[model samples]
Target: MNRLSLVAVAAAVFALPALPAAAQSNEITIGISISTTGPAAALGVPERNALDFVPKEIAGVPLKVIVLDDGGDPTNATTNARRFVTESKADVILGSSTTPPTIAVSNVASEAGIPHLALAPFPLTPERAKWSVVLPQPVPIMGKVIYEHMKAHNVKTVGYIGYSDSYGDLWFNDFKKQAEPMALTLVDEERFARPDTSVAGQVLKLVAANPDAVLVGASGTAAALPQTSLRDRGYKGLIYQTHGAASMDFIRIAGPAAEGVIMASGPVMNPEGQADSALTKKPGLALDTAYEAKYGPNTRSQFAGHSYDAFEVLKRVIPVALKTAKPGTPEFREAIRQAFMSEHEIAATQGVYNWTEKDRSGLDDRSRILLTVKNGKYVPAM
Candidate 1:
């Protein structure tokens, strides 16, 4: 009787229907690598702040976020991406606040077949296209906006000072393409590293060129170095920056030098008083309202808005992915990749995302606005 009863109990236990995969695997891991500690901290800190708004769960699936600081280092970002895939078992990766680090992590994500959404602007290439998407408007689109403004102001010659990195190169190339179309000649081009304490030498050269305007193509607080130097030297032509510098850190660091400076930015920077028909106005205002409520009055950064949009992309795609596979599995990761590729007309804080297999940025002219630093705040340049 004991043997028969024991055998029957064991059989019954084994025969019970296995728990549904979703119930068994109810958590999704998202890995975030940002430059919270280093040169890009001004940009990364706000991005980290925006994560507070990401819901802990979606479609009853618990979300586990693991954030690592890459310190704006490409090597560190690569290591973080690998660790997230191999150790944290992250289904997707987001981060590395600036372009170079984001690009670095993209390689790791592609190798691991994990979907990556970068908050920084990225030039989508064929190799990385399989696994990556970015939140910020592409360089060319934002470049055109700046050049159009320059033409309106009757600026025909420009000088450039940019970071000695891919971010700077991309901006310069894109801006050059636009500048040529508008008959603007770039009189001088100079470069500086992010950690450089001074761009005075480069600024001197740029000012000596006596161009009608100057464009600083660096990001985060570093971009302020050139602007401050230019102002201190009393070179008062026009000064422009890339959208990469659209953070409060740039304003605070540049101080009075930042005033009257013009740049291109996502509409989220100044949502109020926007035309009702503006595509980004409604979503931008919503994000601004939520962000300011949490961080206090007027603390929203366009950099932070990019991170918010990354979450919005996840919100739209992850649910669809869950239908096919459970998280923490290769299939789930691939599902996310496919979902991101096929997404269309998704409105977020920055702009409407309409992605396709070939276009990872999913943003257009509607995504950008021209802004000027006025009274320690960003105002519409139009």
Candidate 2:
């Protein structure tokens, strides 16, 4: 329908970043704003790369996809969303690899009444939750699994060190929510900026507390800082990481410190390790294989799986929405939104989704899988 398939600063599956976006009257435009640089690059780069694999068209309609780099900043994310809405007239949006930026994109999408498939576990607010369906398994759900694993392993007290941002707060709150009722003491809490080179000061505080385990509530390669620092400080406690750290970069960056570190993650992290009967297993394996084939072995990121699943969601719902309204119209966008709420038991690479008008992340317990770094690779913790 249009000469270009995407508009961004980088080469894309369909179009180049140097071109202007397709003039209004989209057949079906999907705008993606992700952190392909800055702190969350580990998550966003894979997510952006996975877009290369999405079908050229869905449901007999040519789709125009536009991607933008937010660099993990909320302000940049917001500007990207505005560009999507004002320039591309995007019917749907996805993006911002980290929580704060994801929320920022969600807010912009909500204002424009576009359906947003968020890639981060952003806080659910009444207004934004209505228009946004998150791709990641919620923090509370992942936290419960980690806390249960902790309790089962006889962990009585915990310490926390994470980003000084909304994502870290979301994880830390879940840590407290699970720990307080379970009678697990929180020994210490520390925070660091995403771009900071050293978390040595925070590591010193956490090591001094010497809790039975320490949970690092950060994502991407930045999440590796605390783990490496804590081990350097000679902290002997078990280390736990949020799903945001469920990536190969953590192992690559943390090196030996990543060993014995456990994380609550999606089935996609180690798809072959999952039971064959699981609905997510096949799709997860497919994405992992495709990504590894293109990017190389052990390169699949859970963030990419989330991006893969967002396309899966569109595949299932676009046909349904087409029956109600033509693409490129607000009515069609609303139809897509309603179509998502109507569908349940969605089997995607990351998890089974069942989003509603009221809920954000529609993932169930089946979405959660535990993994630990073993011999420089991720393995089932169980």
Candidate 3:
């Protein structure tokens, strides 16, 4: 009787499927699809660094990061998004620096019910606002910021130069919209492609239009062309650049030509500037310092700050979702979405990210800090 009973019990135990591991033991997988190469890599690299650092500070359950290079290509962004959702089984996704890839991946992620942390500058219109949220200031608001600065400087008519892409188009259109309300006129509108060495012809058009100021909108090193082209064409009007163009790379590329160019930017008033800024709060400072220490001085550019915030949002949300639900559970994915939308106060060196449903853009207009080039260096505007 004892042998028979023991044999029967062992058989039953072996036949039963093992209970699924508890949330604590289960590892959280977060997908990071970013431009580790291509033009935006300057900012993307810093973003990757922030993602690498998050788990180290937050001590709890195990975390796994599955990184995919978007190659700064929109099609690749969509492909990587699919892989993250289906192959990597990522609970949440974070990244993409411009509108095209961010928008592309957003469609895939939203369709799959996976929440996305959009790091790009483009604002989430009502149409695309359902599933994704951006960590940086929105694209539309930059135009208003630039206008206010332009107005303050007694500038009325402005020239515009932007990349011939969705990212630039959005910013350009928004700038135009904001300019109209302020009684500012767009004297000329110009476009260029990525990796283009010069915009001399475009600059000539802007010059002939007789604008009181010039506005440059684009990501990466392309921002330099406006400054160089403007100078080469012998235009003397003040140059106003979008915040996204406020990069150290732009300064390096334009050199002396960049001088006197004013760019709308988030506050860089020491660490205090981050208090109200979405992308510049506590972790932002930590990231900037760490990057500088590792990559030498000037490692943390303006774009780097926004990218870091994107990674931070991912780090904070994934673990919380994983702890509450299993990997494949819908609740896990929904939690990540709520984490970004409902987040009231995110601490970063850039500023506090008060993300909300109505405003997916984390940055507030109050945090807009104006920066200008002086002596081949970025300095606070007077």
Query: How do all models score by TM-score?
Result: 0.91, 0.94, 0.86
* C-alpha local distance difference test of each model: 0.83, 0.87, 0.68
Model 2: how far residue 75 lies from native, Å = 1.0
Global local distance difference test of model 3: 0.68
Candidates in order: C-alpha RMSD to true structure: 9.5, 4.2, 9.7
List, residue by residue over 138-168, the lDDT tens digit for candidate 2.
Answer: 9988999898899999999999998889988
Each candidate structure's count of clashing pairs: 0, 1, 14
Candidates 1 and 3 compared by TM-score, better number? 1
The most accurate candidate by TM-score is 2
Q: Please give the range of 10 consecutive residues that has the lowest summed lDDT in model 2.
A: 11-20
Tens-digit lDDT string for candidate 1 (264-314): 888888888578987678778877888889988878898888877887888
Model 3 C-alpha lDDT per residue in residues 54-123, reported as the tens digit of each score:
5432335455666777867877788777776665676667768776788877877777777777767654
The runs of at least 3 residues in candidate 2 whose Cα sits more than 4 Å from the true structure, single-residue gaps closed, are 1-4, 9-26
> What lDDT, from 0 to 1, does candidate 2 have?
0.87
State candidate 3's TM-score: 0.86
- Kindly indicate the candidate among 1 and 2 with the higher TM-score: 2
